[model samples]
Target: MGSEGAAADRLLSWDRVSLVIGLLLLIVGHYQGLFVAPAEAMMGDVGRILYVHVPTAWACMLVYTACFVFAGLALWSGKGKWDAAMEASAEVGVLYNALLLIQGSLWARPTWGVFWTWDPRLTTSAIVLVLFVGVLVLRRVITEPERRLNLGSIAAVLAYAGVPIVYFSVKWWRTLHQPFSSPATVSDSFITPLRLAAFGMIFLGIGLIGLRWRALRREVERELSAPALPAALPTLELGQRGPGGAA
Candidate 1:
């Protein structure tokens, strides 16, 4: 019990640390992007959105990738922690993916003069998001833990296949969205803030994932440890003999 208490304390401390660091990074990153970075000559201030937008997009994929890996691990080892991690990653990944689409739309309206298009990158991203959302729905509908875990893990892996497609669609197809593969293409001022925001988002995403996983783990533990309810007493039927033939 003492050891368990110590372990829990350590986890709590780590969670707080992660939350603080993640918040700090995001705050600083936003500051740098808004104040420190120079405005682009072409897009001007609108380009600043890239700092948050691109990072959110990157973090979405990163979290999903982690989800895929966690699902695989859970399935392979049949470990509960891995399932918790997978769930955490998937939920957070979906959130970031949603934000990515919104940010992309916002960026697109100003740059492309339209809120949306059937571009390959955008289409593939939407598909990925939908599939992951299906994973979440599947989890809720399924009641059995093992069954839910198995199905969700499989779905997570299947959905992850779309992530690479989304990533490569820009390169594979002629899309309106510009490929940002080369640092040389972006200005130094933009690069610094972009990197900062990227790190900030990465840290924040990871921290959230950790905290969520731990919370889920605790819930599972409590469910497992909880004593079962006492069995209900059987009622005597009308005109039926009770136990030992008593009325």
Candidate 2:
């Protein structure tokens, strides 16, 4: 009991201000990007979608990178701490991916004249989303923690394999979704706020998911090491792993 309390207390203590300030900066970046930036001579008002769309998409990729790092830790140490990081990162990845879908749709309608398309980048991203969802669902279907962890280990290692392909698919497949508007790909006029938004979202995601990851570590440690508490005590469900306490 005392240890659990200590863990919970320590979770937010680490990066508590960075998390709060980062989120506030992101909100500010969103406002500044949409309202303050100059309109695209080509896309006009709708081009403002880059403000939110780019950051959300960037956050998705950044969070997944965090997952890969955690997976490395887990694979190296054979400890569950890495698994916790991967799980928490994946949860936030889902949220950011969903944000990308919505923002992309809104931007696509004006830019592409359609909300949905068979463009390769668009198509593959949807596939990536499905892949992650499948991973999450697979975790839920299993019951035992040990078995779930084994399966999750496999999934975590495999999930980021699609990233490079996501990055270069535009060149390989040729699509209308526009290549990554990185500093090299775009002019400084467009690059400035987009970069800021991306960095903001990245820091924001790290701080956010990092906190969740710590909680997950504590929870998993408790589950494996702490005594089974009474039924009335709530479990530290940092994020869903699988049914019946495994993973």
Candidate 3:
């Protein structure tokens, strides 16, 4: 028990370290984007939103991808860690997904002249969010730990089907959303901050998932280790006498 606790503490320390590094990187990246990077000829300063927005989008997809992998591992190995990881990643994915939508809307209102539209990318992204949220809801409604893990894993796997569609939607269909940005397409000045922010989001997400995973792993361990309750004593009929009563 002592060794296990120490190991857990060590893991938590690593998570904290990742979080601090990520925060520092994000601070630097956002500062460069806001002050150093030149404004776009068309969108002007508003394009700066992409610094955070693009990074969030990347991290959100990556987290969901991790959730899918964890779900598969949980199903195959029936391990507590994988189950905990799946839940953690799903929760973080949902958070990032929410942020992605809000950021997109903020950028959209100015660029597209509306807060939202049924563009393929936006539609698929929203669906992905709802699907994972359903996974969380299902986990809550089920009480049995093993059963919850099994069903939730299955739900997470199904939810992941939407992630690829979200990624490819812009390419597959006509839409207001732009295609994936790259060195060839984007200006040299924008790449540095974009890469910094993207990596920052990735590390930050890892830290968040790790912290949540630790808490969930402890819960899983406790549930699995708990002794089963003794069977209820058989109830006596109204006319039945107690064991020592006269017949």
The numbered model that scores best in lDDT is 3
lDDT of 3 by residue, 1-247 (tens): 7787797787458778888888888999999989999997789999999899989988998999999999999999887789999999999999999999999889889998999866666667788889999999999999898898899999999878766766576546655556666657899899889889988999999999988998898888677565888877765556665454423
Better of 2 and 3 by lDDT: 3
TM-score for all models, in order of appearance? 0.82, 0.79, 0.86
For 184-240, candidate 1 gives per-residue lDDT tens digits of 788677777777778788888888897788789766444434478888776556665
> Could you tell me how far off, in angstroms, the CA of residue 28 lies in candidate 1 after the best superposition?
1.2
Q: What lDDT tens digits, residue by residue, belong to model 2 across residues 1-247?
A: 6775675577456557668767777777777777777887788877888877877776787787777777677667656667677778877787778777777778778777889766565566676777777777876787665566668757866877876676477446654556556668766667767777787888778777867877777766555465666567554665666446632
Write down the lDDT of every candidate, Cα atoms only: 0.79, 0.72, 0.86
**Which runs in model 3 stand beyond 4 Å of their true positions?**
10-12, 165-176, 226-247
Off by over 4 Å in 2: 1-12, 165-177, 226-247
Error of 3 at 217 (Å): 1.0
Clash pairs for candidate 3: none
Q: Candidate 1 versus the native: TM-score? A: 0.82
lDDT of 1: 0.79
Model 3 scores a C-alpha lDDT of 0.86
For residue 227, model 1's alpha carbon misses the true position, in angstroms, by 8.3
